[model samples]
Target: MRKLTWGVWLGTSMLLAACGGSGGSQDSGLEPPPQDPRFVADNAQWREERRERLLQPDGWASLVGLHRLELNAHYVGSGATNGIRLAKGPEKLGLLQQSGGRVWLVPERGVALTLDGEPVKARFELKPDTDQSPSIVGFDEGNGQLSLLQRSGGKALRVKHADAETRTQFGTLEYWPADAGWRIDASFVPHATPRTLEIMDITSQLQALPNPGVVEFERDGARYRLEALEGEEGGLFLVFADRTSGHESYGPGRYLYTDAPDRSGAVVVDFNRAYNPPCAFTDYATCPLPPHENRMDLAVTAGEKRYRRPTP
Candidate 1:
């Protein structure tokens, strides 16, 4: 874990104190459930389920390699001579050929692979994730899988191995205590014309994601707003940061997703549900950074804390 400099810690402490001080608006009549035994137990159960999902064979933690495809043919394997060398698996996996914006995966002789659980002995077209039914090639007897991913205006082979070191050696997640006070009622301010936000990902690639509107809420008497991105599931996605960002939380920011607004155009901005981006867990993930407008002046002392991997 990276230690926070004294100056940074002091600045964060001052910001937290200011945000929690008397300058904020009065309580908005929203009452949260008491912090009883049942409440604690429920939160514990949720965290457990989250951990289980992370350790899944194909989850983010299983990511082992991300190899950008070239315009020409390339050999993919664990061998050093291969164009895309994998960290694990057979020395000679297959060959990836790209032409005319299309990719094909040609299997090596006697190198067994499965497509939809059926043996694949011949070459087949590989579709990027942008397609509805992209090809998923299974190798290493289902322990390793490969798929085409469209990223940064190009295609790449994403490799997932069940025995990925990160997944096998994952440390427990830490969090600030579950505090219902962090759940605030917010109003959705829709834009007459929806726009696109240029989100810069960890890979330094810019993507234009949908910007539906803004969510306005008050905390500690001070009002704040966060631009909401249209979620794939008809919900709203928020990438934001506060004073806790560089000190007690993931330095970049945290992500939150909320259901669509109700009839009254009201949504609940639950900071308690804020979670660290996939980048926090694995370096292979390409996570979007928070936009300038989404950064908050106040401190959000809720949600998951900085994940410090346990020492060996």
Candidate 2:
């Protein structure tokens, strides 16, 4: 994504001022109440932390390649002649062999290599991210990282480089002004039995992830429901699309994380903390699209706006 320039920032500020505040359209009838000082400060801090994470050395922005392990055994490197050529790495990195449902890597003799941060003088087994401790091959003096990512289809090599253009020239992240009105209190309705949702990712792979429940909330006097997926640390993960999608937000959708529902079935769904998916930052990412049921009829002019990649 392109960094916001001074001119763009000035224009956005002017636009927000003209809109009589942020978070929604001037005529949406969902105008927020007086802004809370603490809410604004906390939201600002969250956005800052989000930005810093994306700018990290091996963050989403640093993703440079996703190559499938096609043949059973193949030479892998940045060289054009290699069977599995990488987008960025040493010319003759190593040879990867797959057999009996397992993969291993044999580093080239002279290349400086490390397997999980230790010197790699011999071939070692490569584990997929699904494992408790996935294997990582580091090269380029620690600037480049290689790992196996298990996708719906099969395992693929995910490459990230600290010097990737996406990271080195990261653009500014923009969001609607934080509003208390967007911080909605809702109810979590659990399923009678455990269920799964077939979510299609950017790569067109269908993933049957766990569907724990549904989050039902009221906005502008209209009730809406979003399917909730099992999230990290027992939280709730939501992928949703609103009226602003394609026009004012990422066309596919945005992601939100909320704490698990309390014993009383109450939950807080803070739209202000919604964020773009990894695909927004790098092409190498495979981000899930919002399920049809989660598409909202209302325009949520809060959270993130559509990202405009920088002009070459």
List the candidates' TM-scores in order. Answer: 0.87, 0.89
Off by over 4 Å in 1: 1-34
**Model 2 misplaced stretches (Cα beyond 4 Å):** 1-33
* TM-score quality measure for candidate 2: 0.89
Q: After aligning candidate 1 to the native by TM-score, how far in Å is the CA of 113 from where it should be?
A: 1.1
**Least lDDT summed over 10 consecutive residues: which range in candidate 1?**
18-27
Q: Which tens-of-lDDT digit does each residue in 173-209 have in candidate 1?
A: 9886778778799999888897998998867789898
**Model-by-model lDDT, in order?**
0.80, 0.84
Q: State the lDDT at 300 in candidate 1.
A: 84
Local error of candidate 2 at residue 251 (angstroms)? 0.7
Best by lDDT: 2
Residue 161 lDDT in model 1? 92
